[model samples]
Target: MSLDYLQLAGTKAKGKRPQFFADSDNERLLSILMAVAGELAVTRERLDTLERLLEAKGLLSQDEIETFTPDSDQAEARGLLQQEYIARILRVVQQEKEALEEQQHCQSNNDLSEIEQELSRI
Candidate 1:
């Protein structure tokens, strides 16, 4: 989602940049957003690869295969730990998704003056 906004900004920059946009512009903002988007994309891809490898190796799996079988107490603890780690990851993903959604909503509907005022309060 952040990438989407960044790509939009980049495309805008590549075309005819308006005069007002250049006025009092935060010169570093667009590049920062783009860098952030790129890093995030890389991170997401790495995470996906890690998940696939973990699945294949029966470390953190989705199906009841050669994975997390409760034979010993240590096995049960390991399974629980993996489950907790996955759950934490899911929660973080959810939070990021929600933050992206909120940012979109704010961008689309909220006025700049309103945002500025809110920021001032902060």
Candidate 2:
């Protein structure tokens, strides 16, 4: 798991650094995406190495690797993890969605209370 290959390509600037992103939000999102991409690249390299080793040992073939499918439970778990990965990438969106849902819930509760009061008056 040597990350020497993942080093950012550039020499450090001698003076004050210019902004890579237009704003703080873009900068944060870019950082998150870069980190995720770097990790995924490392994992992909390791998986490729493993596949080559297995093929060399006569235990697996390139065709088998391409066609590989998990069994039922494994497939389900993989699906769940895939969903989680998407959520992680869109975590800000997920948080905003949850906040909106909570706001709607409170509005709905208030509406319900108003309806009940009108009914009581009637």
Q: Would you list the C-alpha lDDT of every candidate in the order shown? A: 0.56, 0.68
- Mind sharing the TM-score for model 1? 0.32
TM-score of each: 0.32, 0.50
Could you say which candidate leads in lDDT? 2
Tell me the tens digit of each residue's lDDT in model 2 across 2-117. 12222222123356534598885786577558647975998799998999899999999999989988999998877766655555455444454666899999999999999999
Clashing pairs in 1: none
Instruction: Highest TM-score: give the candidate number.
Output: 2
How far does residue 113 in candidate 1 sit from its true spot (Å)?
Answer: 45
Q: Any runs in candidate 2 off by more than 4 Å, and if so which?
A: 1-20, 87-122
Give the alpha carbon lDDT tens digit for every residue of 73-102 in model 1.
878766765554343334324444666899
In candidate 1 the C-alpha lDDT for residue 93 amounts to: 41
